[model samples]
Target: MQSPAAPATPATPATPATPAGNAGGIDPIVALPARALSQEIHARRLSSREVMTAYLDHIARVNPAVNAIVALRERDELLKEADACDAALAQGRPAGWLHGMPQAPKDLAATRGIRTTLGSPIFRDNVPAADAIVVGRARAAGAVLIGKTNTPEFGLGSHTFNPVYGATRNPYDTSRSAGGSSGGAAAALATRMLPVADGSDFGGSLRNPAGFCNVYGMRPSAGRVPYGPGPELFLPQLGCEGPMARTVADLALLLATQSGADPRAPQALPGDPELAALTPASVEAALAADLKGKRVAWLGDWNGYLPMEAGILALCEDALKAFPAFGVDVEAITPPFSPERLWQIWLTHRHFLVGHNLLPHYRNPTRRALLKPEAIWEIEGALKLSATDLHAASVERSAWYQALLGVFARFDYIAVPTAQVFPFDVNETWPKQIAGRAMDTYHRWMEVVCPWTLSGCPVISLPVGFGAQGLPMGMQLIGRPRGDLAVLRLARAYEQERDWVGQHPPRALL
Candidate 1:
């Protein structure tokens, strides 16, 4: 583990940002964690123009290799915005922690005026008139909307690629993938193209990419971050927007800004009053939670019911040691509920939500022809679901929720593998097989994250370490429902112990 990168001035055009190794060449400002970077900007130790100029220069140099950030805004306009933030700050009116920071929302997040293509040629010229709720929050907080991150078409797959912007390659190895629909977000954060990013997760969109990239990402409890003010928020609970950053403290602070209640999102969870108490200055202390006597259930591979690539679980088990070292009890436990049943419940809900949402697109013959097979599959499967099937699946989902509550009664957290396989070839679509077993669906390879997804629990992907091939992997520290902050605290504790901070940068970039 490496010590957290210290804050430094923005790199000059001549300064080499990525050199031979993880430690030496990273630009000082690019190396700083988002929280620390925020402090530098807010305190005026670094002017917004300085901060923005450095990032623009960094992105110009770094983003092309990975293709993580797309549709970059005009450089001059962004610097002008940064100057405005500086002006407001000089007037004692700092917008917030993100003032002057460059952030690229995932392509799925609609940005007003700026192109918001969902990685599809069908909407390549499409630009929303208004910002998506998540994008709006970041803009309001003073983040410079530098550009949009690339994502899969319709944000449909765990891998981030689309016909429009190509694929967002893994920064650790450009030959491999960056997982998605939030893959661009994770990749950008890993390479320091963006200080913090917003992403969405229905399946493993958030966790898988974070794991593959060796960064921190969270799929907050359903409604914890109000994914919408969306057209169909009332129906979808499986997917939600989340925060991703290089460090836990950065992740938590970004989560604080993105979370809160909105009248439009009726099912959104109430904001945590405890979260209100968190400031960038005190985030480290807030996250340094004492884990003495806390109990964790390590449900690896779901008792071998789910297949995994070689060395994946071993890496996870090794990381789990951080818990016991904190005086938290780590027990390997298998749930009494059938893993297959839970998977079915997950598939049913996922198909229903995805299908219904894309029905309008599917209905048009010309548009349907433009749809990817995965999107077509989801809608077709959804069409087969009768109200009775929907009702039965809903009942099973409820049963699993109750079943999960029983497990939570005994343990404060459950740890699981964030991804079953490591980063695969960037050009390949999805993993068709794992450990010699065929994946029946495009997403079955990601089933490890499904059970937790079904529970709608707050799950954070903790950067455990790298695999034999040098690809990074993460462990899912899943908290009880609505236990968003608890999960962060535990993730922070594990991160602190691993000391896996400053040193372990993307070697490919370095």
Candidate 2:
């Protein structure tokens, strides 16, 4: 992949700047939520050119240390797009939802004319001639393409590190991980380098990194946001692409643009009519989602069956207490399921799918050496499974889903910690252990996230507060299957009282 160009001086603006406050070299416009910024741009309170310039300056100044944005488009071309946006607005043409915002697609997603390495040396210079469905949606919504963020090699493990561009460090602490495979997206959001970001999740790629970086990430209900295509179309509840941002409302805006009917994806849902019709006003209005009289179940560590690091349970418990204050009845509850069985099922399906899709690369003489150890382990594990084993695992997954549905029958929402542990050292590919228990595999440390993924339910990771070590801790909110709108509403209500989403990492880390 091409290295990001040296920060270029922003082009002269075609329209004047907005009246927002500017202090400490930070553009006050950058602090505004994406929804609000879109309004400002439309109202002529801010120009698309000015907004894009501010973000470019911010990215140039802050991205080097964390290395979240591994590749970039020339500043001049991005500014030109922004200028065209302003010109259209000047002519009184209606703008799309994200008009003029700067965004970088996750490396795993294809982008036309831009290098999408998927963090692998083998495809280091590969560029697609077309945009992934999600990227097309964002561009149609008026987002100016900046570049692609970093990810793990083939997104094999939760951690985001690859030989192509190296690891993406947490913005909170340069020495620690940002979490993956959405690590770059989360870190970019935390540092205010981009207004909003896009990511995909399977086994906590979206939620874990958002937790680690103190941002908000949503794993929309299966089929709510459709993935375009990949090596294989069918798998055991494979990954879903979703939105990430500093605020739930911003996330809502991005989601609205990305969620829609796609004939190519047979699993795609006919999304919420309201969400499909979402506007800036609608997104802003969702912030007032009523929490009164709602029933919430707080499942902390699956009743202590799931291993977690020190302070995580207590931190999550304290975070859930706010639900009561929001007028929701909150109680500790255990969903019926064996954590061990669920983990085994998840591994069986995940390994089988990944292995089936990627094994050919391993066998190829040209690409064999490019395979990472974690990828090899997963593919080999898949080799040991029989057809009967896959069917049995599918049956177990169904049982797990039914058990979660039983819990949902008793509560409107279930809350849990987003990760088993907080951010670990960036240099380490995966945690050796958590809470004194030796992790049996590179992915076992993130088993807390697999249950929700396995259930195919809507999940959101919200920044609650910090840990004893000052790294961010996030709590997960799981909605019943296909309850994407409801889950987002609950998150919006909670975000109203918490300032965690608005908090930024220490400036020193940048």
Candidate 3:
């Protein structure tokens, strides 16, 4: 934990003059949570076109500074989406959960008639003829497509810089990074460029940027949200797409619209829960405030393999202590497996996937140059791995999963700092070190985030507190496998108890 920086005087951005005495109007539409706008639309207090126009206007205003959005549909096309929503209203018909909302998807997700560059020059002019499953569902539910958000080249790195669209700066501070490969999506949400955005996480793509930008992000359990339009479409046990928003409620709203089992998935199960039904009020009502009667554990420092920032541990400690105030009996608990072994297993699995799927692109000088060196390195490393090594790693991964059963026996939830340190210089590839210990790998410091990724557990990063430099910090709440609602319930209660939603960045342009 780094020492807290001295608190500075709160600075406000020069308030833009309100048009036509509309004091409440003209504020960034992107800032309003999705649920708020949906309610406004359902009540007919605001037209869908008005919401779409406000966001389009904001994108015009801020895209230069952040480079968050990639492609905007023609104005007529956007108006058509809004017109359809208005027509439904005229017919006395109810729109779906996200009826008439505006949103931006990561460029990695295919969008029909919209160019999805994937942050590479090769696909700069490429446009898919059909929407990916998730995008189609959102559009059918009445979510107007605002544009495409940026990503790292092929979404291979943690930072959101690429040749096609360039870099997306942190909304809080221009010089700092917004975090990546979901960096642009997080940046858009933080600055209210969109009320809600879509993001995918194979590693810490979703959570990292959320923590970096002080927003709520969830990486749902594997198969919770279907992913496709990629080379490997059937493997639901690995990566998935989820939602990001300014608040948990908005994230839930978007998740509900996009989540379900696709017929294409062989392992797909029936009855994906509707996310819209999980409201903040309903979730809070379900969560027990006091953990005193419940068992809770904190995997502090993960057996001391990774170094944490100075105050990070303290902030987490304070948050954990407060859980007992909510009646959770808090105690320290250890996993049955070693952290080193788990890291090895994770590396093995990740390398094989990347190597087999992505290595050939690295062989082409043109394609190789378009990708980040880190991505190439990962592929090359994976290519060299032997079958014996992969088999051993698989065995270890299973053993680790079984080890988690013991922890589940005594505790209902596990807590850890979302990232080892708070947001750092956005220009760097990854944090070089933490608390003086050398961070040798690009993803080493993110070890706390990997356990849940590997185990396919439902995890949510809640804005717990702030640390040095006035930047926000979050603690991850890890739930038992398939306990998505339970984790969200606890997060909703904390949000109500803490009321951290109103904390916004300074208005001054840096």
> Best TM-score goes to which candidate?
1
Backbone steric clashes in candidate 2, count: 0
lDDT tens readout by residue for model 3, 298-369 = 777776776888667666666665565555666776555788888888888887876667777787888877
Candidate 2 TM-score versus the reference: 0.93
Candidate 2 Cα misplacement greater than 4 A, ranges: 1-25, 508-510
Predicted structure with the largest lDDT when compared to the true one: 1
Cα lDDT tens digits, model 2, 262-292, are 8767778886788877788776675566678
What residue pairs clash in candidate 2, if any at all?
none
Ranking by lDDT: 1, 2, 3
lDDT of each: 0.85, 0.82, 0.73
Query: What lDDT score goes with residue 335 in model 2?
Result: 50
Q: Choose 1 or 3, whichever is better by TM-score.
A: 1
Residue 56 local lDDT, model 2: 85
| Order by TM-score, highest first | 1, 2, 3
**What TM-score does each of the candidates earn?**
0.95, 0.93, 0.89
Q: Give residue 477's error in model 2 in angstroms.
A: 0.3
Better of 2 and 3 by TM-score: 2
